[model samples]
Target: MNLSPAERRAGITVAIFCIAAAALAFGLTLPLLGLLMERDGWSRSAIGLSSAMAPLAILMVSQFMPRLVARFGAKRVILIAALSDAVLLILLKITDDYYLWLPIRFLMGIAISALFVTSESWINEVTENHNRGRVMAIYNIMLSAGFASGPLILVVVGIEGWAPFAAGAIVMMLASLPMIFAKVADPPFEGTASFSVWRYFLVAPTLAGAMLLFAIVENGSTSLLAVYGVRNGLPEGEAVTLISAVVFGGMVMALPVGWLADRMDRIRLLVMLAFMTTAMAILIPWTIADPVWRLVVLFAWGAAASSIYTVAMALQGERFKGADLVTANAAFGTIYGIGSLAGPLVIGGAMDYDDPHGFAWTIIIICAGFLVFTVIRQSMKRG
Candidate 1:
């Protein structure tokens, strides 16, 4: 654990260069999420099933990630992820079949898992204990900014044919080239012990519960906003913006939330966010024809909700260490995955009311669920 000046500099450099590459996919993936879902004429079931594969895949694969990192090395896996991500974007642009999209999305999920795990693992290995929190905060900011950028790119590309997808792929390719030159190794895996995910959830129930609830709300929001748009008869391009607006809204507040995370009681902050988010969701269903107001409402929801991820992860960082840490990470990953799968399933299924404004009810239902969870967690006193 001690590092020379040269080593510290090198680690930070690698994180920056590689993270930028990975961030490209974040921006590209935004519009593509809508495009992919719509292109295939996917039922809510199909979108839920396909989208669920990412977190599911993460859970199944993370158990063996240490071994993978040990063998292929982190740099190689990241490069592979980048290359595959580029290819998948190309494939997504060309395909409109539901059947084909399932496998492609699953593979895209794999690529996403690889880059995220590798980026986090690499940083953990290089950073000092004193700096770990700060570095992670920085990384989260980068991811948020990168993710927010995706929608802006879509706005630029104007979302017809393969243009947006192609642009996304190009960004991924560009990110990969510089990292390919750096060729960093996988940082050492921190934890090795196995623990039940349920046990870890108990250790920090508020943070853990918040992670799960927000995952569904956030992922569901991201995945289905476009379809919600199309169902309401908005232009396809405009439909994609609904989701992006929310994400960009979230990004706008990410830095402030990170700053607050250092100052506030994260648990209390999360509880407040739960209330704010629920309010946003309730407003979603009523904004059908009000384009101006829809943006305002979703943006508010995004701003309030974005902090959940950072704070929850901090709770994890506080309570666990070693292999136990990784176990907790995987557990959170599982909860997030399950919630994500359920979001679209529940919302999409509830579309029994075809009224143009009924779409916002989905947000309302999701927000209400978050409210219930918040009350439960806040009221429960862990002895």
Candidate 2:
């Protein structure tokens, strides 16, 4: 896996592109996934259930990825995952019933997990410690791009039409070809299957806590803020913009945060991120005056929150390995899926009271998670 510097850069660039594309194509629709579910004759709760399956898929996928990578190679695993997701996304346009989509959504989750695991693993396996932070920063940036771009794709495709799914499918299909042609030496990160979920706290508590809390805050915010905005009296378009602002702002800031995370004390930096995000959530309901101010607040919120996922990953790289790493990711995925499930249900319920009510729930959740996280650090014996 010793690549020339130029080759390393190219490999990273390709990996970033593929991962971003994969995340963008699917992750973007999440904000409106529940709305889409309603259009097709389901409740927000049901939609949340389907969307929650994604995290569960991540949990299930990580448990098996060691063997999958061993048998299929990381590249092939990514290809199959991407291809499987593309097809399922296209099928969403064809089906209006939830019964069919439940399983479809479940499979889509698996596809995303497979794609992401392979995409990151490919680069992480090859990168030296010196360059890993920059590589991770770039990777996180691309993910932000994919997620933010999903709504824009909505503008062109409309939530009801087939066009968005087609575009998503095409992007995923195209993302795979680069790996097929590129020269890469496989450093399969394999290990004994023997491991426990609880062991993750021992291997990497910062990574574990960060992933759990961030999963709740990140996906919850992304998935529910649209409905939250509307409750606050924003026009449909502006409400949509708030979601985009958070994602784009988060994307722009993730790299700098990654750099700082790399250079400074990681736990302290993570604590800073938690406080920053919690503060932003606190500001949201209070600062809903002019549309411009609201957008700025949303942007700041995204910038602060997106770092949770990226930094948690960097922390994992900083400590855990092999089975421990996979288990941590799986546990994160499971908890994140649970968060995704709760977000829409709770937030959608908030919309019933009005938008600020939803924001209140979100704010409380953010603060509670961060506060709990801060206290948990006291008991953790750092690796």
Candidate 3:
């Protein structure tokens, strides 16, 4: 398991590239699909359900990912998943029926979950605990940058034809090239057959909670932010740009937050982030009329909300190792899948009920709930 520093850096770089590529594709696809569906007269609820399919697929498949990687090896599994994603993106471009899209999106979700679970576990496996916070921060920074680039690309391409889909598929295929020639061996899986992924939630309830909260917020915002912007009177181009603004905030602030995670009590850091996120959500309804202020609020909001996952992942690496670590990561993906499924459903429903402002209110409520739960969890532990 001991790798020279250069070897470790190479491993980390390849893994990050793979995951970030997937993020880029997802970032492009989610909003692109949402805007397309909206243009075709799909209901908000129906669009939410369609958006939920990927995470639903993630929830169904994530628990098995560690075992799949163990059997197939990380590089092979990632290669296959990346290929599958490219093919699925092409299928989405060909199909015009919403019913068909349900299954296509679900299948794409499975591929994405595999990419996430395998790459994340691989990165943690190669990292030393002492520097995990900083490394994961850099990991997330790349991830957020990938996400930000997606919406920016969409703004340029205009989501009119096959161009956006073709662009996404090309990125998916290209991202896998690094893995095809990677020299490092896959990390050994030492988890026993009897180990349950759910047990990790009991072992690290706060980490589990943080991940779920993050999933709900991240998926909800990314999938629906464009829709929200349009409903509130922004042009389609401007609406899509809002997504980039949010992700750009996360990209800008991840390093500082990561640095803080390494030096502070992480639980306290999570609390502060939760508070910041809730406050930003409160300001959104007020700021929507002002473009510059809206971006500023969302940028700060994205920074705080996104850091929750960075700190939580760093904590998971600090707390577990080997087979257990892989299993814990699978559990993390599972919880994220669950949150992803619920986020769009709930937030979309709220928006359907109340229009544009519901989006802001739903985020506020979710962040507040997590903030309360985290505070109580900390208090009980101290007692």
Candidate with best TM-score: 3
Please, what are the lDDT tens digits per residue for candidate 2 over residues 52-130?
6776676565556655766787777887887888888778768856778777877888888777766666666566665
Task: List candidate 2 stretches off by more than 4 Å.
Answer: 28-53, 59-61, 90-98, 157-164, 290-292, 322-324, 346-355, 375-383
Q: Residues 77-186, candidate 3, lDDT per residue (tens digit)?
A: 99999999999999998987899999999999999989988888889888987788889999999887787678778988889889999999999999889988778667
TM-score of each: 0.74, 0.85, 0.88
Q: lDDT per residue, candidate 1, 6-123, as tens digits?
A: 7765766676556666676655674567555767576756665665656667655655544555567667777788889899878976785667866787787767767775666566
Model 3: per-residue Cα lDDT at residue 342: 86
Clashes in model 1: which pairs? 27-150, 191-322, 191-323, 192-323, 284-360, 285-360
**Candidate 3 lDDT trough over 10 residues, lowest sum:** 187-196
As for TM-score, the candidate ahead, 2 or 3, is: 3
- Quote the positional error of residue 338 for candidate 1 in Å: 2.3
Error of 3 at 256 (Å): 0.8
Which regions of candidate 3 deviate over 4 angstroms? 32-46, 93-97, 151-164, 193-195, 225-242, 286-293, 352-356
